[model samples]
Target: SVILFLNKVVISQVICKALLVPINPLFVCSRHIRNRYKRISASKMESATEPGESVAGKSTAMTAGQKKEDRMKRFRELHLKRNEARKLNHQEMVEEDKRLKLPSNWEAKKARMEWELQEGEKKNDCLARGEDYERVKLLEVSAEDAERWERKKKKKNPDPGFSGYAEAQLRQYHRLTKQIRPDMEEYEKQREACGEDFHPTTNSLIHGTHVPSKQGIDRMVEDVSEKQIEKRAKYSRRRAYNDDADIDYINERNAKFNKKAERFYGKYTAEIKQNLERGTAV
Candidate 1:
């Protein structure tokens, strides 16, 4: 019984020494980690059952995986809290225009009013200085200004309906005609002169389909000849070239080019040209 008791003491002491010794955990795979912890726990259990001296508790050091998980959990908590606050603030803010559902023309309205105010100020200054204020109108480019510009352009530059002639005189005619007033008296007098044959057709009187009149035939012939004469006079122009003028260029095109070059550099080279001509140039 004494020998058996000594053997048990020695065995317990050896197991206690092994358990108390610190484990240097090498950085390895999960399989090695699980096996290492299981072996230490199994030894602890065996020692617990037949222990003479009690070993101090095993100090479990954290694994790399557990440390990484804790770090990620903290990160999520911080970012999520900040992002949720921002979202709540965004939802709380309300714009007046959006809330009222009004068409946003703030930019265009502000620009137009500002322009009017500036013009008024300018006019006041001009009056104080005893100068006539010429109305200098220029529309500013803006968001809603497109529609206004379209209407103005349509009214001012109206499309003239097609006529037998080019009808070029209609352009700028509005500016001249603005001062001219309607003469209903003259219009009625002209209508009376035309009579019932107001809508005249060509060769109607000549073929006797309409009653022929010597006066109307003569009037028609006279009108046609006058128009022909007026057309010829309108296009004809007298162009005379001077024979006395110096011919310094090859052609009209070359003449234009030489004139341009001379206009740009003539002053700079004038003295040099004079020196060369006098045989004094080095």
Candidate 2:
């Protein structure tokens, strides 16, 4: 039974070696077999230690600690080169052109130059054919260009997020105006038709004194005004002070006190208040 057990273990070790995997540490035969295996391995190691008998270009003389230290040294030199860099003079760096020369509005300037060149080439052809060199620029901006400009403006004058307690409905209303593309030609025509005495304040269309654009909006507004206008606006629920009122109050009671104070001091400090609001106060 012991011999058969040894046969199985020998087969397993041979299989592990063939598979190039470590022999299982838990695998055990009797003490005698283990001792015999150790002796055979020792003899093999001794044979390998013979000069010119080892694997070519491989040395086994260095201890693990020595090998690890050499590997670390090589790694520091190869990958982590800060130690080598420390020896160089950082003060003697090549003078970099921090301010690269560029003409004012270089982007637009370059575009204009290219456009002019193209126009010069077209001018000769146009004169030969008796045609005028009309404007190459488009009147309407692309959605992407408008979006880019809007984004730039927003960066300078950022809009509040919904979470920031902003007026969501009011913001949405203002945003809707951007999407409304009014007929510029019709607008210009109307302006020309209007007499020289036409002021913006007196312009019926501008002030919405004209009939409502919607079919039945006039009737609905009139009907609503008769019933709901007085009832709904009997007492204003929302604050009715200047929309540009300073927000210095922390609580409801503080806000009421501030509102009362503003009424009395508002006239006296109006200019100062405006300066502060506009960030022009020294």
Candidate 3:
């Protein structure tokens, strides 16, 4: 009986030790992992809170009154900058206007005359060399076609009667005379000043007409050819005068925008000041 009781007690003790040994280490490791995760989370929370606290403190230090004053100061500074920029741009535009003279209508007319003279010379050369008239014919056809197209495109109602024809003739005459009137007047004045003593060269005279010498004619031709070549090169490469006009237009547009901006800035500043005085500024 005593031997059986001792065996039973020892068996029970061995069973309890086998179950607890496996479970004890697993529980201890799980608790240690949980504690490590808690520490990491606590550190992250502290790091995030520190910056937030500092920002809150700073914001609290800056009162509503101080913020309003700062905004007003910034508004004034912005207007001052706008005014300065406008003034500087105006000064620059004034200097540019002084430096670059815009081409007038008279200058454009002169250029047109020079171009026409060159074209006349080309046509004369072609005819003098006895070249085929195909190119000339083509040019004439093209000009006629362009004129026809223009006439067709612009449908102007013509007036019936001699009044319309007379008005058109008068308009054409005025247009032709506009440029030469000043030149003709100047020449008349010069002739009058010279008086009756001035003897104009005539083809039929007692000493005969003084014709240009061969050397003088050649020199004149050379000068004319050089001028034609220069003009051809200038127009063929690019219209530099047109580019100048475009630059002037862009500068003027920019100056106008700057002026508008200055006006807007002034108006905005005035409104803000009025609001502040009434204690209604945001």
Candidate 4:
């Protein structure tokens, strides 16, 4: 009866809103109508509430208690729910187990095993074929292909990436080498042109068939030896510039000799004065 009433009310609202105008719009207070509908909805919602039951039929029970009767009841409910869930989970896991397990039929199982065994071999063969293809492709590069690649590369970078300074440096090096080549070649030619007769002696002087005359050689040798001896003698005679002992000894000896000579002169002069006075008196 209540459901029939609700259905009729919904239908009337939907149909009458567009077709029938309200005799007295003030009689239908929108706020009062909404409040009435809200109260009805709340009552329905409260009456519909049940323990451990949701709109989706899932249980949300709180079975915690100390009484033996409540505990047993809770255990029974929990065991029932667990059994139901286990049944459904077992059904799901059965498919997964089938996926994991070998087939039961011997021939089909043997075929699957063989396929699994040869899977690695087939992959290896494919890999080997791919490697062979790569090797063949690498070996198949012809001179024309190389030349084409070279042309592409040459076209890509025909210009050297050197700045003016770098180019000038390279040009300078080339010019220097060009200038040095003649000198090096001339040196080599001179070295080659000279025979044993123009070779240097042990003294690093050019002493060969074209050397100075024997007389000149002997005079030069004698002069050099004499100069070396004189240099040694001068070095041996040389004393440190700050040597003071010899200077001090010579100064003391000169002082003593000067004092002795002055005394002898003074004594003789005294004797001459006395003798001259004596002769005058006579």
The 0-to-1 C-alpha lDDT of every candidate, in the order given, reads: 0.65, 0.67, 0.66, 0.62
Backbone clash count, each prediction separately: 0, 0, 0, 0
**TM-score ranking of the models:** 1, 2, 3, 4
Q: Model 1, range 135-167, lDDT digits (tens) per residue? A: 333333564686787888888954433221435
TM-score of 3: 0.19
lDDT score for residue 161 of model 4: 27
Candidate 1, residue 180: the lDDT equals: 53
Tens-digit lDDT string for candidate 2 (1-282): 578777877988898899998986365555557877899999998887875655432455446668899999998777657745654535234222322356558779889999989878877777787766553222345779978988888789653233222466677568656765776776676667665634655544545544434634765586467745676468455444666856789997787777666756879888998899899999
Which number leads on TM-score? 1
User: Scored by Cα lDDT, where does model 4 land?
Assistant: 0.62
**All candidates: CA RMSD in angstroms?**
22.2, 27.2, 27.0, 40.6
Q: Which stretches of candidate 2 lie over 4 Å from their true place?
A: 1-103, 125-132, 135-282
TM-scores for every predicted model: 0.22, 0.20, 0.19, 0.15
Model 4, TM vs. native: 0.15
Residue-wise C-alpha lDDT for candidate 3, range 78-157, written one tens digit per residue: 99999999999999999789657765575688899999898788778889999755676466677679788789777565
For model 3, give the 10-residue run with minimal summed lDDT.
239-248
Model 4 Cα lDDT, one tens digit per residue, 1-282: 457555656665676677885433334345456777999999988778853256435421322233666879899999999999999999999977876785558568788899977766756775877765445555768989989998899889433322346665786577546743244655566567665434666755443534344765786587568865687478634223544532323574674564455445867666765777689633
**Model 1 alpha-carbon drift over 4 Å, by segment:** 1-92, 96-100, 135-282
